[model samples]
Target chain A: MTKKNKSALSEHTGISSPEITSSNAIETLKAKRKARIDTNTLVSSILNKNIAALSRAITLVESENHKHLEQANTIIKACLPHANKSIRIGITGVPGVGKSTFIEAFGKHLTSQGKRIAILAIDPTSSITKGSILGDKTRMETLAKDENAFIRPSASGTSLGGVARKTRESIILCEAAGFDVILIETLGVGQSETTVHSMIDFFLLLKLAGAGDELQGIKRGIIEMADAIAINKADGENLKQAKLAKVEFNRALHLYPPKPSQWSPKVMLCSALQNEGIKDIWKLILEYKTKTTENNYFETNRTKQNKFWLIQTIENELKRSFFNKKEIKEALEAQLKLIETNKTTPFAAADYLLSLNKSLQ
Target chain B: MTKKNKSALSEHTGISSPEITSSNAIETLKAKRKARIDTNTLVSSILNKNIAALSRAITLVESENHKHLEQANTIIKACLPHANKSIRIGITGVPGVGKSTFIEAFGKHLTSQGKRIAILAIDPTSSITKGSILGDKTRMETLAKDENAFIRPSASGTSLGGVARKTRESIILCEAAGFDVILIETLGVGQSETTVHSMIDFFLLLKLAGAGDELQGIKRGIIEMADAIAINKADGENLKQAKLAKVEFNRALHLYPPKPSQWSPKVMLCSALQNEGIKDIWKLILEYKTKTTENNYFETNRTKQNKFWLIQTIENELKRSFFNKKEIKEALEAQLKLIETNKTTPFAAADYLLSLNKSLQ
Candidate 1:
């Protein structure tokens, strides 16, 4: 059997099957044909709200093969009519901000409220080491095992936004499966949180009380983008500081002027470890939803995010394509070599590369 | 007289002549014209290596009047031929890194060796209040008094980068005024260091001996870009800790593979206040010049930097023009309002704005 057909059969069973042995090519070919038909049935099933088929479709979408994106796109398009029903929330915090613990408690809370939750984790590939912890499932074991909860770790990838694109597409799959809430969790390492914020309806930033760095004007810049800021670990002695932080954040939030939505940003203290403020957080999110939906901010924010992604995607593609040409590549290296040797300047080299690429094209 | 001629007369003499009174329309115009002519002559004299003219040209470049950019650009272009001769270095650190003392001692050493020097200070601007310290010249008293040295404090401006761009252009003006070396000092606050690095030939990052946060990868990213990491405040008691910090930095530097130029980044210790190791730092830079010049890295690096600026300029212009359109402005504001009110998603809003702009164009 062909490699494509063999993989097709493996994709049929909702597993990232690592091994494929086609000793009986004829039988394997027949099975592959059956798998292809099954995939179509699975796509339809997902669209019809079949949870198992929805899981299978997401696995297919995460595949690295070119054929998988095509198949995933097809499945997503088929499921589109039934998708987009869920409220997607993105939560980001520094490493020890109780992201997984909070998510588990939050997922359970949503399930108790008759809402099926899907959680997707986004992890960035370290540019130099090319290693990722890929520890999403391990961190949220309870949520992963819960019947009403769906959890997926990030697929190892090149760009943070690349991982986000797949997760975004997978969100459509989950929503089609009748999941009413989707929660995306990302660590505040690097710029991945920005990517996460672009894909979600509301962005929540969790901060530790006293250990916050003063120079990190992140609170100022990010607070403008966020729907809410929660000072985590706010239970015991930290409660006073947390209150102080909330007040400070409220002041900072006020400094931003009234948002265009005419909604004031919310800041609250929480003990994610104690699960004390999780419900209140949820209530605040609901408030955010009701207010934004009533004022049309929810849909407008999502639309703006989509446009941001489209432009970003196009620009990245243009840069990659322009740099990937053979002549341009050779000239760039040659120019860098010259730069290294003190014979030319970086700006001159860049100009040379631009002109070379233009001429080649 | 035209507005150009009035400015010329005002520039040659510090005080405005009574005949150039502000009341008479034509005389006022002539006075403006005289000031302009005086400024132009001053700019020309500065272009021809007059120190005062160079300083005034920089002041004009930093002015709010839109017409100053035209004159500034003209002055910069005229001085371009005399520029690119110096080893432009950017030194940055947080407050209390002994920046003023270091620059004074370093400037003294360079000037003592018969190397004319120019120091441009880029002070941080308060985002909310727009307040700036703007007092580096007073701090570097010795260097300020030295005939061989020129010290200019931060120009009033919009951004750190804005200040840097104007300073970079001013570096050309200073170089034309016969300065052989230009040192730009920036505040070591987050991305500001990186911004300064992007504009210079060599970048130096200064840190204290007892910084606990150094290991959390705060310094690692910038370490890769540094030509040298100098542990300052390395006195008697701080000696051991400084050595330890140097060792730690060396380890971190090792993680970064050799630069494209194949230059091995160096880490050293210094007591800038005590005037220790100042000459060695200059020696290292001299060695860098010798090595890179011999290997052609020096010229190529400058060329590449210019190319980078060109592309950056083009990209900024494209974005500016896109936003400049009246129709695009209306659509964007409308879409942003929708996003705020939840009527549309950010993605959809961006898409709508882009399409509207395209159609309108």
Candidate 2:
């Protein structure tokens, strides 16, 4: 038997076949390669300026799968030390405000100055609306083809909180990849701007001339969050109107209480359409960075933001877990019916539901 | 048998005499009475308009003892069927805006119209500040002595949410006790007004003429929540400024979105110190009631408010239970430290703390 050394399959078939040899060990090695310690390898690749690996890591971070989330946590933990070295800027405007044009122009300016820029979006409704599909690249053709620029569309999630979380994680990955400037774009008309504001170093608001948008911004509390207001489209016949808007926004920005940064907000005119006055806006942000950094508000604000996220995450997950249970869903319906029938008070019903959850635990 | 009855106590304690009686049986009867469900009796008494029973029930509601809360729940569950009959009005203003006088004047007006009124304060009291104490009664002396009115000071609690809950339950008790009107008062400078607004049918904000207060109101979003703005201190030389403020506030009110009740908020001038414009305010409220009721918005809004309260109670209790646990507290501190040292992300830290809490269950 030793001399023959026949395989089991060959013996069962009563045939001697040396050509039927198989290497199960080799296949096993190949199979185990991806499953083994991908987190460390991905972090090293991201640090090595490997864009493909960075994109893969972000996909894992955005995945709703349980196992993917665990892997993403490992990668995020490894990347945290290398992260937070870049300047984060948030840009917002309503639809038809030339956000795409402004971002492209702003990004081109930075890249020309030897800066690597990354653009991320926080629109939860992007999947249905003017999403970042292949057609979006056409809107920013020159920037999309630039070697120093990376553009990722908004992550799709059913909830704003969920999407905001993924974008936050993606920022870490992008920063680890050595992006010098990160522009976070969001619509100025909703809560997304507020969420984006909490995560950025400087927030910029863009406005077209005389769109009746200032009142909308004031009513939505967006004006208070803005660190700089740029009256875009300040070229051709729009120049006169844009100048007027700048003075109006200047007056509006002054009414806000002094920022904790101790840096006064400004209103500037620019023409993303003509790529005019774009560098001045960048200079203003750098000035804000210098002022806030000197006053130590820069680091203090980040610390406060981190604390906010920690508490927000725990509270949100607590509610999600409590509400997601099958038992809770069925019992909550019954309790609400009891409430409508006048058989229970809201407080009493709340107590009963909580007690039921406790027992389940 | 008689010898044995006397001997048990004496055998245990040889100093016991005949005069030393033990009421183990009768004391048990007295103790068991409160342990029994007094819900039905309290409900009947409340239905009969017994103010003493209402007061006792409210005391139970305000009590911190676990047993008392349980009894309070029973009483509230019984009162739920008879509650929601009266309109709840929330009155708010700055500390020096003569809120007490306005409430007194407002309370007496209703009582004189043959309406039984109940006034409750929700200031979330502390040791300092101008709290509602004996001086408060002196401030509202006429209304306090009126047979048709009931005035209670703010209930004390460790948290604003706790105080709000107690006051809300007290509102139910008052309504079941045949109160035709319920006034819930809170300070305008803080978060309590928003909490008060959620539970009320109408919201009233009192302002002083030309006190540089409208800007503060707008900043706080109190003006947007108001159903009616009443300018107090409108007598004598202040009358002209009050008229000017009325126009300014009217312009400001028009800028807000249309209210769900289809009611345009009114800006009225009143001198609470002189009891001016009091009758017109009442008539306006009456008109509002009739209009909202005709369009079915009244019932719809109440249903929405009930839903809000139910979800609010559950969410609040869930957070309280999680944070109150000693194990979660220690582990959360460690997790937060990990976040500070960059050993974990906030999202990751939240996950770990939540997992630690899960194992605790």
Candidate 3:
């Protein structure tokens, strides 16, 4: 099919548009002719560190089309052996915490050290915005212009799970494309922070100084997930308050039960705007990486995260299938009504609903 | 069938022996004839505050026997209208934190105020020990002897879900049995704290004075869930440290995001041994109850909890059914092996496995 006709077919069939392939496939022949270009072409290109091919492969991974799924799977499987070679770091902070500026500074520092960086995001709210908050490249102008830096915004308009799964797959493609550092950014609100935390080697929480409101909007659980917290915008007059906030955060952290990682979470001060303390932040991350790697927590955590994602994927798929059943959907509404009225206990209602589905037997 | 014959039949069928009704049914008539006595009898007896009947009803709720499930469901449904009339409190602490002593004192105080208190525990670890820590009533000598108090140990040897479901049902029965206060105790070690925290109207965390180890073994998440924290052993030489600890705890708690309950979590010093601050703790609970009730948080929270449990029960049942599938089980084992060997991505393996299951289709 012509590229135009292929996309028309895709649209008709509800497949997401294959952005890069369209141009070339249009200049090519029929549908059967396209099969001649195997997933190996994509795999070889990604392995050769071709950015366009890497981006296209990520698009395939993110596509909801069942048609592209098999090809995406093939490409990801081929890339797997080359993955896990990079350091995956998760960065999160509330809006207005200068996350983009911090990333630009951090990315520049790493690239100066001859490190290739790939930045991905897991923004649950992107669905509402219809585009990621970081979709605008101007936010991180310096890093966006750097050849060694690859900055991809959050995949918009998808469930957190969907976004997380795609981003995780994209990380593999990025690593296979020869990136040495993966920076996964997430908005501090909602469950995205936890999602990002699970997939990364090190988790950094960015906070503002002089905001007793610091812990106000962020969950204590999220704070506890941090491997280190950096008090952002620590330049000029904010310096003193940032140091004090650092002390307070350190004290608060001490009151927590030690993490299973056996590495104590550290608190630091940084000024992304002034490009101050950026190197120290990177140093802290390197220190953590070295310590956890020595204790084997770094590798073990990745393995555990793999197992966790496996179970999580199974559960999500199971829930989707069960809830998608026409009978279950109807029965669940009735059972929820019964529960809301307090006429039946939740356990009994669950039993009744399960009984309605013979497939469960 | 005769009582002896019925029990023999039960043994043959691998059914658990009916502890309370066997003899009466044996003296009366056949197995089917005894079931005709109805769950109403259990409900009415519980409504009249018959302690023995209440205990038997709880046992029915706790039973793993599929035969007793319907009866338990019916009894719980009958008791639903009378439930939620009492304050349900969850108490947790590490083993040496004097939880039982504190509870005994707390129970005595409530009864002294003309309140009838029922203490129930959900200890998942009790099964491993083969005896509940609270199973020894001699530990709470004063409360055990108090006529207005009813103390029951954890139901041993069941999954956390099973135990939590039973204890939740027991709370309904206790409230229907005219108990104005329901105290749910759980060891601070595991997921039981989160379970207990969910069912109760208020959660109280017990701590020790001089132990910087206060937060050592307990999860910070659990601490965040607390409505109040009481530093125990606040007597004699420990008084100064207790006061200091209380202040420190207060400051630590202040750093936490405000709870949805809008009641700031209070930290106080209490000597369960000396009975100091016991009344004040009760007053704190009363104040919390008043504030939350005034804001309608009490009712809204209960509703939210009901919905939460409803969804949790459904998810648990769905997982149980899915994992219990023979084909899925075998496939999962194979897939996990592939995962461990890094042959397939977890998402791909999950997709392949889900495709293998007809039910998922």
* lDDT for each candidate structure: 0.72, 0.85, 0.85
> Over the stretch B1-361, how does candidate 1's per-residue lDDT look in tens digits?
3456676446443466676444678777877787679757876697566778878888877776867765666666556666678889989777787878888889999999999998886654732244443263677788889988988777766555556566666777787788899998876665666667767788887888777545323422565678998889899999999999899888867766578666787988888888898888888988888888888887777766655654554344345456778887777777666544445433344446665655664
Tens-digit per-residue lDDT, A1-25, candidate 1: 3356665336444556654665588
Indicate the docking level reached by candidate 2.
Answer: medium
- What local lDDT score does residue B79 receive in model 2, on the 0 to 100 scale? 80
Instruction: Compose the digit string of candidate 2's lDDT tens values, residues A187-228.
Output: 776788889988899999998889986656875678888899
Worst 10 residues of 1 chain A by lDDT: A212-221
| Candidate 3: stretches off by over 4 Å | A1-29, A32-38, A207-297, A359-361, B1-29, B38-40, B213-219, B237-269, B283-294, B359-361
DockQ per candidate, 2 decimals = 0.11, 0.60, 0.43
Off by over 4 Å in 1: A1-173, A180-361, B1-44, B123-136, B215-220, B323-333
* Residue pairs in clash, model 2: none
Q: TM-scores for all candidates?
A: 0.58, 0.90, 0.84
Give me the displacement of residue B204 in model 3, in angstroms. 2.6
Which candidate leads the pack in DockQ? 2
Q: Is candidate 1 or candidate 3 better by lDDT?
A: 3
lDDT of 2 by residue, B226-314 (tens): 99999989899999999998998899898888999999999988888889998888898998899999999888887777778888998
State the lDDT of candidate 3 residue by residue for A158-273, as single tens digits.
Answer: 57887888988999999999999999998877778878888999999899987655444334467778889999999999999999999988987876678988989999999988
